[model samples]
Target: MIKSVAHAMIYVLNQDEALDFYKNKLGFEVGDDMKVEGGFRWLTVYPKTQSQLQLVLAEPKEGPLFTKDSAEKIRSLIEEGAFGAGVFETENCQKTYEELVAKGVEFIQPPTEQLYGVEAMGIDNSGNWFSLVQREK
Candidate 1:
């Protein structure tokens, strides 16, 4: 039986830059960063407060999981902003948006009041959009 999600994958153009964005800009801590068998880098990062769930920062490449053509397609789609990492929760959408913008993060939509909460849309370094939401009490 499924219990809970321990890790999720986020495809990136460059793992190093993604690491910089998630770790430095988003203030997520590196959970694991090591080269596993077959020279595959096993990298994961998580919010300091949410260490149980780690986001795997992976670079699409020609590997067992992807052929060269498929890898290229995925990479192209990522470059065109055709993917979204996921929604990230914060206590204050406006404040968090401002902080991320200050760190050179690009936002497509500023914080706006929604039926559920204040939400903002931003793109990661790899061109994947993610929502920042502050849920209403």
Candidate 2:
């Protein structure tokens, strides 16, 4: 049987910039930062609440998972906003949105009530769209 998702990978143009954006602005804590085989660096971060799940911030250049051309193509697609990263559930959408905005995070939409819940849309540094949602009681 299939298990729960362990992590999600996001290709970043610059690892350092992505690390800073995710850590400082978005409040994710660094999970791993180490060099592995073939001169590749493995970097990952996790949300403060979901510490068990890691988000890999991978550079798409030549390596095991991607070729140089493929990396460029993926980066281009991400820049064009063709990626949707799905929603992350939060305890309070309004509070989280406000806190993120205060930290200079750009949001595409403010907290609004929807059929599913109270949600807000935002983009990461690399242009992947994500929604922050809070279920109504």
Candidate 3:
């Protein structure tokens, strides 16, 4: 049975930059970073409190995940900021947004009240946008 999520992926232009962004900007901790067989680097990170799941910092190139053409297409999309990494929950959307902004994270939208929560939209270093939300209590 599928009990929980293991890894979520976000294709990046550079792994080192992504590591710095996620680790330094987003305050995520390194989960695993090692060279696996077939010349792939298995790099993953997780939120400080959420160690059960990892966010895979993928470089979608001509490898196990994509062909050359497909990789190029994905790279183009990422460069264009045409992808999203889904919602990330936070305890305080406004506070978190300010912290992230101070750390050089770019936000397309500042935190605002929504029916379900307070939300802000931000872009990762790879151009993937994600929603930061603090749900209504």
Best by TM-score: 1
* RMSD to truth, every model: 0.8, 1.5, 1.1
TM agreement with the true structure for every prediction: 0.97, 0.90, 0.95
Q: Per-residue lDDT of 46-96 in model 3, one digit per residue for the tens?
A: 999999989999987887878899999999999999888778999999999
Please say which candidate is ahead in TM-score: 2 or 3: 3
Model 2 residue runs over 4 Å out of place are: none
Q: Which pairs, if any, clash in model 2?
A: none
Compared with the true structure, what per-residue lDDT tens digits does model 2 show for residues 1-137?
97787778887777899899989988889999999899798899998888878998887788887888998899898889888766778989999999999988889999999998899999888787889999887
Best by lDDT: 1
Sort by lDDT, best first: 1, 3, 2
The C-alpha local distance difference test score for the whole of candidate 3 amounts to 0.92
Candidate 1 TM-score to native: 0.97
* Better model by TM-score: candidate 1 vs candidate 2: 1
Candidates 2 and 3 compared: the better one by lDDT is 3
Prediction 1 global C-alpha lDDT: 0.95
Runs of candidate 1 exceeding 4 Å displacement: none
